[model samples]
Target: MDQSFSGSIRWAGDNSKCLDVQGGSPLVGAHVGLWACRADHPNQQFAWTEGDGRIRWLTYPSLCLTAAAPGLPIQLDLCDSPTAPFDAAAHGTKAICTSEGVCMTVQDTEAALMLMMLGLGSCFLMMTPLSAFWRVTAAADAHDARLGRRLGWEQPGLMLMMLVFLAMVLMDINFCPHLGREQLQLMLMMLGVLVIVMLLMMPLMMLMMFVFHGALGVNGCG
Candidate 1:
């Protein structure tokens, strides 16, 4: 790595926070995140190595700030590791910094594509389970007054609104270079996981609702 300027990389959008290594850990995959700027935190120190734009951790010069892959969190990795994804020669994790050294960002077409796939694809997948859940509920033959009533667009509409809000927030990366690709990727992955968990719980939730409503109907009839 070509050594250049050394300093605490602060978020340009919010100067109060600086880039930090999670737990000050020396582990290869230790996460990188933003933290309150501290003048003396070794984990907050970084050097913008010029040529390849590698952000080298000054405390451990051999470890470079690396974006392991698209849709994954940023982490520390050996500067010259021979591993397929960690190979420094590929320069896949190279970052571009502002002239004043206030911010940094990794620009990669692949990473952007992965973020889109994870966010939009997962939301579309959720529609199937959501539709099925509503269908099952609508078809239930219980003597409850609400049986056979089809659900309106409210549920899915709310989900889509939530997704839109998330995307709006993540889109700040374009305006604020310091927002970082990993943060966006991590959030998208989280959205995907949340959708999956909701899908898995749909059946159980529907079953419980039926049991509770049926018990109410029986008691009313008695």
Candidate 2:
């Protein structure tokens, strides 16, 4: 081993626990996760890859944690191959720079990226329905006429919000070097929750409006 560390490998995002194999299995291809660290647990012991960013199991130095593909569960495999693709994406990374080396565990990075991607997709999907609904439906009684029209498509307000969100995401790359993993994780989690709550509230808001109008009539008369 190039460098050995005695402490269990705690997750970069959550330091309360340590990386461990499922069911404490020493076999090849065992799935890994964060588990409560115990001094006697062989599965928790790991060597820090300070030199190559390749985490090695202390009990089995032959096995190194590797991601077989993007979005796949990481597993322990022999590090014997010389031509193995340690590509950041294959390891489920948001990105990989040769200058920086591997940054974090594949699953953790993949999950964070996937969550953001899915949120953006959801926002886009909602835009299509809203645009169509506003166009086909007549609200002649309504006082406001601003439907966010463009050359062809609509929903300017929503599209602007999405653009702003994307800008923040893009800007974060420049901001990452200054922040630690835990702080970055907290920011990601907070942003995720905010977006999710905002989306969910749209339905709740519609429901509340319907209930209010039904109870007191649309014209405020019983």
Candidate 3:
């Protein structure tokens, strides 16, 4: 091994992390994430071809850095062979060139504003159906109370659950925005699971509404 850092492409800072293939896995889909610089790590070695503008993995000469799409994870893929069609997107776009050989670009402020707007829109979309369902339940319970029947707890229970859900959503939006990449990924995973669960429960919610209304109608409480 050469005793110099000529082959290693690392960040400009003295202690900055290097671009590393996650876990040093030799698989085609191995993720490219940042890791602490290790002089001896082959995963941190990459070759940038100025002529073709392709960043190739030195550990696997046949593999090159490939991006499937915008906002997706980068991974190693088979290098574009001569027979393959020329993919103009494989090259980098215009960016703020730095003295450290790092390309910088300012994030679009409109994107952030649109994301915030989408989040608020989703909250309202979710709340609209829930609030309407709870209103129906409240009306049923009110009728039952007038008829000398015991009041059901479903209305209050749903309200409490909704409050807790909103609180969690608010925390996610207002809490620390400087979380580490891994922490942010974990949080997003958990949120995704929560969303899946809510989606799956939609049918069950409909069933509950049908049963509650049916029972109330039979008791002349609707």
Model 1 lDDT on a 0 to 1 scale: 0.45
Q: What is the per-residue lDDT of model 1 for residues 5-83, given as tens digits with 9 covering 90 to 100?
A: 5656543223355568878898898877766667657987776565655667889988886653334556788867532
Q: Which stretches of candidate 3 lie over 4 Å from their true place?
A: 1-6, 12-15, 81-222
- Model 2 spans > 4 angstroms off: 4-6, 49-52, 82-222
Q: What is the lDDT of residue 198 in candidate 3?
A: 40
Best by lDDT: 1
> What's the candidate order when arranged by decreasing lDDT?
1, 2, 3
TM-score for model 1? Answer: 0.38
* Model 1 Cα shift for residue 176 (angstroms): 39
Clashing pairs in 2: none
Cα lDDT computed for each candidate against the true fold = 0.45, 0.42, 0.40
Global local distance difference test of model 2: 0.42
How does candidate 3 fare on TM-score? 0.34
lDDT of 1 at 91: 16
Writing each residue's lDDT as its tens digit, candidate 2 over 52-149 gives 64556778777766655433555677766331223221111022211213222323443322101111122232332221121111123122223232
